[model samples]
Target: MAGVAAIGAADLVAGFGLAGALVLPAEDPESVLAAWRSLPPDTAVIVLSDAAAEVLRAEPAVRAPDAPLTVVLP
Candidate 1:
């Protein structure tokens, strides 16, 4: 888990060059969905957990083709 956290942090830093804001969603699915839906179209959502990522991927509200969503699982 520590290694995953370290990689996630590094990825966050590397993603800074992108054109949108970086979002780290909560562990819960509902919270993740809420945060994802609230972000702008260009925003980058970094989902760390497999569970949350699965939920977000299944959620239609956050599945816009134009939305920049990234799911990182470990």
Candidate 2:
């Protein structure tokens, strides 16, 4: 379970049969967007707070048909 923050890191795991999970911070929408863009198709992105989820949903790029984005509220 590696924390990937860039496209290069995501590329490293390509074809390794590894599942990628991105845990995003609530306060940093830009970071979330960056991470979302960096991940490969089918990556599971978990947004930790509603604030972050809102931010993610607002970003048009985050709504990829092939990727799964989940919002986990506490």
Worst 10 residues of 1 by lDDT: 1-10
CA lDDT scores, all candidates in order: 0.48, 0.47
lDDT of 1 by residue, 1-74 (tens): 11111012334433533533353435456666665555544444444456656766676655567545465655
Please, what are the lDDT tens digits per residue for candidate 2 over residues 13-69? 232334443433323667656656666554554434455556666766656664555
- What lDDT is reached at residue 61 by model 1? 58
Flag clash pairs in model 1: none
Clashing residue pairs in all predictions, respectively, total 0, 0
Which candidate leads in lDDT?
1
Go through the candidates in order and give the C-alpha RMSD of each one to the true structure: 8.4, 8.5
